[model samples]
Target: MNFDLQGRVAVVTGGASGIGLAVSRAAADQDMAVAVLDNNAQAVEAATAELQDRGFKCLGLVVDVTESESVARAVADVEASLGSIDALVACAGISQNTPVVDMSDEEWDRLVAVNQRGVFTVAREIGRRMVARGSGAMVVIGSTDTIGGHINHAAYAATKHAVAGFVQSAAIEWGRAGVRINVVAPGAVDTPLLRTKFDDETAQRVLLYNVPMGRLSRPAEQANASLFLLSDAASYVTGTTLCVDGGLTTGFFYNDQVH
Candidate 1:
């Protein structure tokens, strides 16, 4: 099946690095006019320039997803300068791994602010525009941790679960209006963010033991999933979380004895 996104305009949050950057590049590769929104001004400028050097129609804007006003301004800027936003990929988020009992109010609040609330802010603003235009698609980057609880990740998991709910509810409400909302729940991807979680040896062992694929997922893999969800190829898909977790959520176990 063809996954053509030619002439489309896509806005990706947290697009300066990690999964967001990868998705931005993928969208550009598909000939879509792309914009990268990040809180880091330098990074956003650099990334946007790099993509432009590579012959992609791109723009960069500094945005703090946690603030509704900031999000609205950024979306407005993109719409005014970059043409109508055909797709929005809410890839901006943060993660924390504090145990539930040890988690502080601040930690929980920060995670919710950046992850769940950020998602809400971006989706709401973009969804409003999409509804006004009567057509659009949104892909939210979530986590597989939301499926089966992970140790020391209560705050992160909670936000991801909320994302799922938001996607479903939004989809139900907006589907008939020619809009689609979906979530891409990634497993342990080998991005800079994941690298910060553990030492090399420990990270490898964890992936080998837990991930059925026996390795961390690549950023490109997740980007591909996002691209599909955002493209017309997935026109009929909405309100669903596509788990691109390398079989992590499918259930795997360790056996004491070797076969």
Candidate 2:
């Protein structure tokens, strides 16, 4: 399906790598002018260079989403360089696997800052413009943990839950303003983030065991979902969390080979 996104401008937070990078590339592939925002300056340079080499209009900026002033500056820069933002994909986030009892105050606060506040900061910064302009689309990267419970993911899951709630509220408030907001909840995506959380064996024994697809999702797969949500095809879609998991949240898949 044509995304009807050509010549538009898109800003992707955490677009330097992983699913965010994939989304940035996909948006550029659809002929959208892309702005990549990330905290890691080196990764931002590399990603932007790669996209430019591929003949896509791309800009990379070092942005700390946790800081509202930093986000404001980045947003202003994106607008100044690329034009009015037509789309935003809030994919900047971090993950940790410490159990709640064993989690430290620093760890919890850090998770909340990056995962929770980062999403809110970027969305709000861009959302205000979208609301004023009366046209925009946004997709936040959520997780299966947003809906289901997970062990050793207390803080991460909490932040994702908060994101889900924020999307719902934003959708309600922004719907009349022609600004759409939604989320893509991925399960066991094959990104660096996932690899750090589970090794090959542990992934199979712990995470993949519950997946009916019996495989992990690719970063592009998640990006595809985000792209759709950001496209005109999803103009009527907002304030929803679309799960891109490979049936990981459907239920436990017992491989007993029942005949």
The local lDDT score (0 to 100) that residue 148 gets in candidate 2 is: 69
- Candidate 1 at residue 120, lDDT? 94
44-154: candidate 1 lDDT, tens digit per residue: 989999999999999899999999999999888998888999999999998875668998999999999999999999999989989989999999999886565666778
Candidate 1 worst ten-residue window by lDDT: 250-259
Q: List the residue pairs that clash in candidate 2.
A: none
Query: Which digits, one per residue and each the tens of the lDDT, describe model 2 over residues 120-219?
Result: 9999999999999999999999999888667778899899999999999999999999999999999888888778667887778876776889888999
Q: Which sections of candidate 1 miss by over 4 Å? A: 252-259
Kindly report which residue stretches of model 2 are placed more than 4 angstroms away from their true locations once superposed.
196-199, 252-259
The global Cα lDDT (0 to 1) of model 2 is 0.91
| C-alpha lDDT of all candidate models, in order | 0.88, 0.91
TM-score of 1: 0.94
